[model samples]
Target: MSSPRKTSPGKRMTAGLLVMAGLLLVREFAPESPIAIAALIIGLIALLIIIPAYFRALLSSRRDR
Candidate 1:
């Protein structure tokens, strides 16, 4: 059996912010389009995943130190 690799908290947060920026840009540039709504939904999902993953990594790293 092999253990899964850990992801860096910083990376997750960076990705989340980037997704948010992309979503915002899409919405700003094309508010009447369907893609903007899709971006918003995807961005929210990315944020939901990122926040918890980032915290989990942060706490575990602290615990190990």
Candidate 2:
């Protein structure tokens, strides 16, 4: 039997970013909803924060290899 593989942090962050992007797309059709507005705000903030961190981690990890 094969053991379950562990997911790396970078991959987890990518999934999160993809989800956030999906929410942003959904927000386009429901711009009047307060919840969607809040989600857009939160998602933008997360993208701003996570994108930089993801790139830095990716670069550092590659350098370590």
Identify the leading candidate in terms of TM-score.
Answer: 1
- Which pairs of residues clash in candidate 1, taking residues 3 or more apart in a chain or in different chains? none
Clashing pairs in 2: none
Per-residue lDDT value at 62 in model 1: 95
What are the TM-scores, per candidate, against the unseen true structure?
0.73, 0.57
TM-score of 1: 0.73
In every candidate, how many clashes are there?
0, 0
What would the per-residue lDDT of candidate 1 be over residues 1-65, giving only the tens digit for each residue?
99998767777888888888889999999999999889989988988978897888789889999
**lDDT, residue 34, candidate 2:** 91
lDDT by residue for model 2 (1-65), tens: 99999766677688778878888877987888897978888888778767776877788799999
